[model samples]
Target chain A: MSLVRLCLIMLALLALAAAVAILLGETPLSLGQYLQALTHPASPPGEVLWTIRAPRVAMAILVGGALGLAGATMQGLLRNPLADPGVLGVSAISGLGAALAIAGGLAAVPGAIELSALAGALVAGGAVVAIALRLREPEALILFGVAISAFGGALTALVFNLAPSPVAIAEILAWLMGSVENRDWTDSLRAIVPMAVGAALCLKAGRGLRMLTLGEEAARMSGLPMPRLRAYAVAGAALLTGAAVAGAGVIGFVGLAAPHMVRALVKDDPRRILWPSALAGALLLVVADLAARLAPTDQELKLGVVTALFGAPVFALLAWRAARSWRS
Target chain B: MTAAWTLNGVSARLNGKRALDAADLVAWPGEVVGVVGPNGAGKTSLLRAGLGLLPLTSGEARLSGQRLDQLTAAQRAGLVGYLPQDRRVAWNLPAEVVAGLGAIDLPEVQALILARDRLASVGAGDLATRGVLDMSGGERARVLLARLLCARAPLLVADEPIAGLDPDAQLLTLDLLRAEAARGAAVVVTLHDLSLAARCCDRVIVLDQGRVAAEGVPGVALASDVLARVFKLDGALVESPAGPVLAARRL
Candidate 1:
């Protein structure tokens, strides 16, 4: 299929999923009631749909798209199919930031938690790039990222250990579990600009990513500015990942699975994988969030928990297929 | 005309060891140059340095009478086409897409046409739409050769282009290189087959232990003494119907 047609199909599916997500939350509404509620803001059902569910759905789309695009860019830059945005420790650091905010009594303030998370993610991303400047090998860069991720995880644990109250610890733990629950328009607005900027940068770097598949030596021989391209891709991915982590908690597996899903449908060209991966990611998260809402448990499952439950099996299958093809 | 590519006293280090020690060579347009050496002889290093892909620890590499370092990336790409020793494609992209990567600035239609034409020139036209990873070793080599040809650069630097090919494919590859030379492009290739080098190259350069051990016409450069000292082979130049051939016995 043509890229345009495939993208259109994904967009349509995303719209359908978005509608389902908005209509089926704690206060379920029929299609007719949902439409009526959207049109009339005075009714309680209408107000609930517009003010609460709509923002959550929008957050899912934005955060999912950001993570998906970031993952595709990271995979292309590292030339590893398994690479994800979290592989560089950005998400873990973001988690640490949110933990700090909740532990410090700042969670009561709107946007404070998100701002802290974004700050932490940016710092982690910057450190990765600084280390990458000295290390030309992709393996070395990944190793450095792993070390940073471990450190961030330790810090998060430290925050948990030093919590002064059970309420603060519970809030931090719930936030770390990853969800778009209770998010409002303010969260979406805060994330959109950085998400858009990050997506644009990743899309622009597609050409360089295509050339990079030829390997570093061949890419240099082809006249590609390796250092500049690498820097741009890493920084752009970090931005998207940071923004997504700030908007939602550290949602796992969307970044890792979305691009691979798209690659199975389209060609493996890194340039071609970006937008499709983003759309697929949005769809995946929206559906996963809806499933979380509909689960039989009294309390809704966390978005991150639902994704990991589904995504890990899918990832294993992908790995198996890759290994099989390689053997043949 | 100025030499198409030149390396003057160029030295490079790889993994803290000298890979090219004060290597000096020149390749001119309309000539085919063969670099022959054993496993650690710095043939790959020479080609890489000549293409300005490797940083020279000292000395200079020049192309078209300009210092290599002075040229921008795009300019360097326009001047030299390089094929590294390893021919692995990490992704499963189509062969045509792989070849079209050489000239990404062109329109899609133009790049596709160029890629197809180059594949046909290398006798792998049917493999254009095939996945690179699915092809046999010989098929992959031909496709990669087409990619190298797609650059249409003034100087072509191919390291061990015919390493895994059968006899006929090997001859076809050599003939293709010679054709590129005849088209006024300087072609530099690394070869392990001394007989093929003797038959195909206009001039031969023999490297031993990261240095130029011998260089001149094939007969002079591949002299038995040089072969014995460098390759450690009991070999002699012999007359054959095709051209000069190397007949070797166990050392």
Candidate 2:
């Protein structure tokens, strides 16, 4: 299928998933009733829809798209399919930042934890980029990311150990598992601008990313400014991943899986993969969120938990195939 | 008149060892100059320095009488086209698309047409729609050569352009480079097959240990004494019916 047709299908699927998520909440509503609530105002159902479901759905799409675009950019910049947003240590540092906010009793504040997570992500991403500038090798960049992730993980553990209360520890742990639960318009608004900017940056860098598929020397010979392109790609990915993590916690696997899935369907042109991967990301997250809500258990499953459960096996299979090809 | 590309007193160190030591060479338009050397003799470094892809430690490389470092990246690309020794395609893009990458700044339609024409010139017209990942080494080399040709730069620098190709493909590549020179482009290619070099090149520069050992017409540069001294081989330049051939055996 053409890339445009596939993207349209993904968008339609996303709309359908959003409808299901809105209609099948704790107090289920029929299609007619939902339409009435959407069209009419000053009704209890309308109020519930506006105040709850709309923001949550918007957040899911934004976060998912952000992570997906970031993943695609990371993979292209590194010239490795195994790269993802988390590979740069953004998500882990974001988690550490949230843990600190929770342990410090700042969870009661409206945007404090989100702000902290964003800060942490930027710092980690910046550090990785600084190191990458000095060390141009892609493998070395990933190794630095691994080291930063370990540091962030250790920091989060220390926060857990020093938690003031068991309730605070539970909240921090649950947040790390990732969710869009109870997010309001404020959260959605906070994430949208940065995500838009980041996506735009990725789009601008897409042509260079495509050229890079020819390898660094060839791309440079073709007139691409290597240092500038690398910087833009890294910063764009950081913006996207940081914004997504701030809004919805550290959601796992969407960045890795969305781009991979889209590449399977479309040509692997890095420029061509950006938007479809974003749509696939949104589609993946909405479906995962819907599954989380529809599970038979009394409490909903975490979004990260569901995505990892589904995405890890697929990733493992891809890695195995890539390794086999390399060996042969 | 300024040469198409020139390296004057150029020195470079790669991985903490001297790769090019005050190497001086000039390539003019309307000629194909072949560089020949044994392993680790800095042929790649000479090409790279001429393209300004490597920084000179002590001297300058120029294009059209201007220092390479003084030009913008786009300007440099417009002046010199380069093909590295390692040909790697990370994805399964079509051959046409890969060739079009050389002229990425052009409009899609123009670039595609240019790519197709280049592929056809190199006898790779049938492989335009084929995936590069599916191509054999020789086919890939042809496609990549087409890409370098698509750049249409005044100077083309290629490292080991016919390394893995069969004899026919090797001749085809040499012909394509000659054709580029016929069109007023200066073609600089590093070659391992001395016989091909002798048969094809307008001039040959023999390198030994990061410096020029001998340079002139192919017959003079590949003399028996230079071959024995630089390559450690007992050899002679035999006059075959086709041309001068370097017949050599290990010492």
Candidate 3:
């Protein structure tokens, strides 16, 4: 299929999923109420649609698109198909920060925990980029990121272990499990703005990533600014991943799977894969969230858990295909 | 007259080892300068160091008479293009996409047009839409050549341009390089194939142990004794249907 056609299909799919998510939440809304709610925000049904479903849907879209775009950029930057937004450990670092805030009794404040997560993400991004500038090999870049990710994950767990009370522990654990439920407009804005900036930066760096398909030396020889490109790619991904984690709390699999799902449709152009991957991610997350809502269980399935259940198989498939043809 | 590209008393290091030392080479416009050496003799390093890809440890380099260090990357790119030794591409992108990457500053459509034109010039026009990863080594090499051509810079540096090819493909690449030189670009290439170098190049520079050992026309620079000492081999220039080729043997 043509890239344009595939992108349109992916966008249409995402829109359909989003419409379903918004129209059929805990309190199903008739088409009239859906339109009426938009017109009257103060009514009870309006509050459910606007305050509950709409924001949740928007949060899903923002988080999914951010992660998917970040993953595609990260993969292109590293020249590795196995890479994702979390490869640099930014998500875990942000989670650690948010967990620290929650355990420190900051969950009462609306945006304080997210602010902390953003701070942690920036610090981690700087540290990783500092290490990246000195490293001569891409393998070393991955190794450093993996190390930081492990360290962040361990520290977050430690924070969970040492929470002052059972309530703090539960809050931290819930935040870490990842979800987009019951989010408001303010919360979505917390992520949506930074994610937009991050997406723009990644898009601008797309051509450099395209040049990288020729190999590192050739790309550099082609006059690409290596350090700047590295910084932009890492920083942009950090912002996107940080925002996603802040809004939805460490959703995985979408970043790893969305790009791969649309990769064949785009002919392996890293830059070209960004938009389709974002659409794929948005679609994936909306559908997953819907599944979570409608599943026949006592408690709702966590968004992260559902993604992992499906993403692991995709991960295995990607690994299998990567071995067969690195290009494809 | 100012040379198209020049490296003066240049040296470079890789992995804490001296890969190039005080090597000097200058290629004028409208000429193919073949850099020939044994394995690890620093031919690649010389080209890289001179092109300012690898920074010089202790000397100077220039493109079109402009000091390389003073030139912005874009300015340098405007002056020259490079084709490194590795022919492997990291994606399954169409050949035109890969080729258009060289001219990315242009609008996408214009770049693809230039890339397709370059592909046709290299005789790989039919493969414009083919995925580079799916092509055979020879076909991919031609696509890479098209990418190099897409730059359309006046000074072209290609390392080991004819490595790992059938005789016909090797001849095709050589012909393309010569064609670029004929179009008034200064062509620099590295080759282990002495016969092909002697036949295709206007001048040949021989390197041994990180320094230029001999440089002149192929007949003198690759004269028998120089070949024996530097390359540890004996060689004789012989006439073939294609051209004069240097047939070499172990010492």
Candidate 1 runs further than 4 Å off: A30-32, A100-151, A325-328
Candidate 1 chain A TM is: 0.89
DockQ ranking, best first: 2, 1, 3
Judged by DockQ cut-offs, the docking class of candidate 1 is medium
Give one digit per residue, the lDDT tens place, for model 3 in A237-293.
Answer: 888888888888877778889898888888999988988988888888999998888
lDDT values for all models: 0.86, 0.85, 0.86
Q: Per-residue CA lDDT of candidate 1, range A16-107, in tens?
A: 99987877777767777867897887688887887888899999999999999998887887676766767678889988998999999998
Error of 3 at B169 (Å): 0.5
Write one digit per residue (lDDT tens) for candidate 3, span B1-251: 67999999999998799999899999999999999998989998898888777878998999999999998777888889899887778778999999988885689999999999999998999999999989998999999999998888999899888889999999999999999999999999999888888999999999998999999999998898888889888778888897887777788
Worst 10 residues of 2 chain B by lDDT: B47-56
TM-score of 1: 0.93
Which ten residues in a row are the worst by lDDT in model 1 chain A? Answer: A131-140
lDDT score at residue A269, model 1, on the 0-100 scale: 82
**What are the TM-scores, per candidate, against the unseen true structure?**
0.93, 0.93, 0.92
* DockQ of candidate 2 relative to the true structure: 0.69
